[model samples]
Target: MKWSEFKIHTTNEAIEPVSNILHEAGASGVVIEDRNDLDKDWSTMYGTIYELDPENYPEEGVYIKAYLPVNSFLGETVEEIKQAINNLETFDIDIGHNKVTISEINEEEWATAWKKYYKPVKISDKITITPTWEDYQPVSSDEIIIELDPGMAFGTGTHPTTVLSLQALERYIQTGDSVMDVGSGSGVLSIGAILLGAADVQAFDLDEVAVKSTTINVKLNKVQDRVTTRQNDLLKDIDVQADVIVSNILAEIIVKTTQEAYQLIKPGGYFITSGIINAKKELVKQDLEKQGFNIVETNQMEDWISIIAQKPE
Candidate 1:
């Protein structure tokens, strides 16, 4: 159960592309964090700052963390990693030459140990995610339920991107609307979408944790019949059309997936996007406009923005 931790220092701009490449290359979990976060030690705490809720900050940048199985680098793994790291022309990057760390662990022991860092998270006024190990009482017997221990999946509903995405979901979900949550981490948005009123919700994430978390969360919320989590990217493999399409991911991925989001929507359907840095507002706006989505409104919390757009009739 040993893991190889690959820390790559890349220009803030190249973080997403690098993550995508590694993800395609079969990395387990990839995380991006600000350089300033490195100073914070979470050995006793969560070792990571800024929850993945996506509803907290406005804009930020940092280093990327990608973890791979130890066997992936049995021999010369460091060298292979270095070569992969150096090949990226998307941004500036640095390495300590021998800074790569490879360590073994008892998977169960490590997983259990990390669960201590998890706590219950409140995503919105009506939605609450409590880890199985914590004590929490729902505002209502059935208002919302997301029983999960945070691991490497997204959506404790703590990050600005996720928070904003869920907030946007609150405004538009109707009792019978078919909804799609692209990059649905931990199935938070999908779960929220279902709780909010959407009858049939379909979600997708590129990560296995996301897929697994979404399934686990659906059961936790008792919405298995309404919310369906799929393993797909954008709408590349999801064939169903939806009334609402939500994406809480980086701007570059947003741009790349814009068309698919548009296609997923029925005429005049809605598209809600968060996980956008304030600086990239225009880039997203332009992409939406080009694809015939009229920007209805944009909400910003801290430096992050969540925009709501409508597919034209």
Candidate 2:
């Protein structure tokens, strides 16, 4: 089968939303090529090698690439993706050049070529995300391994936004705590929550595709019995209190759920929010505070920020 490589050249700030657009447009796997990664001081603590080629990355902005099968509706799908990306600007997200290009490739090539971009990496002290195809052994007795298939989800669970969320979960999640994962794309966070000692998790996503992806990934990690995947708008008309509520989505959407999150969290519970750019960090902080949450911690990885707040007991 033939596939079209749909590539978008945009700013670092737009990577989350733009990659989301591509996923919503039915692109199963997305590849991000950020020039800044070339200079990043990746940790070799676990012997996770990153063999990136300079030629594959952009000089300035990042490149978000995905593969879509060649079909009659391909043109319309691409246009919808472009429109959705442009719509992100209304949320104050910078779309940068937003230049798009397309190329044709064989299925055999894409099936394995993209795998090189992903490998076992320790995002946090306790959590290490490895693609399903890789054979990785725990470097420590307490090391947590999360197996993910990027082709089956929106993200590979290695993005900075996700890493921050998982790290926050690692820090705040108590043993046998109940966790509610909003915007649970790829079910990575939900799975991570369970691995981090959460008794059970209620994973919700507005996108049916995301829900399906979450369900698949949850089972892949052998945590299906502990994670429940649901298709629902962000915390709307849902009233299940949890020990922790974690969401890694756009700051705009994160703010919208602040009230619901506050009400749904148990007293002294925690709320963790990520997928926020540096500029919008303060916006989320203020909103959470307005909803009566006490700011506990704020962390940043690269250009993304994660804010953790606790409800007064």
Task: Name the top TM-score candidate.
Answer: 2
Instruction: State each model's CA lDDT, in order.
Output: 0.68, 0.91
Taking all chains together, the TM-score of candidate 2 against the true structure is: 0.97
For each candidate in turn, the TM-score is 0.72, 0.97
lDDT of 1 by residue, 241-261 (tens): 899999888776789888878
lDDT of 2: 0.91
Give the alpha carbon lDDT tens digit for every residue of 1-313 in model 2.
8999999999988987787788888886888899988888776443444798999998898999999999999999999998999998898889999999999999997787678889998888888899888999998999999999888587788778998999999999999999999999899999999999999999999988789999988999999999999999999999779999999999999999999999999999999999999989899999999999999999998889999999999
Q: Which candidate leads the pack in lDDT?
A: 2
After superposition, the stretches of candidate 2 with alpha carbons farther than 4 Å from their true spots are 44-49
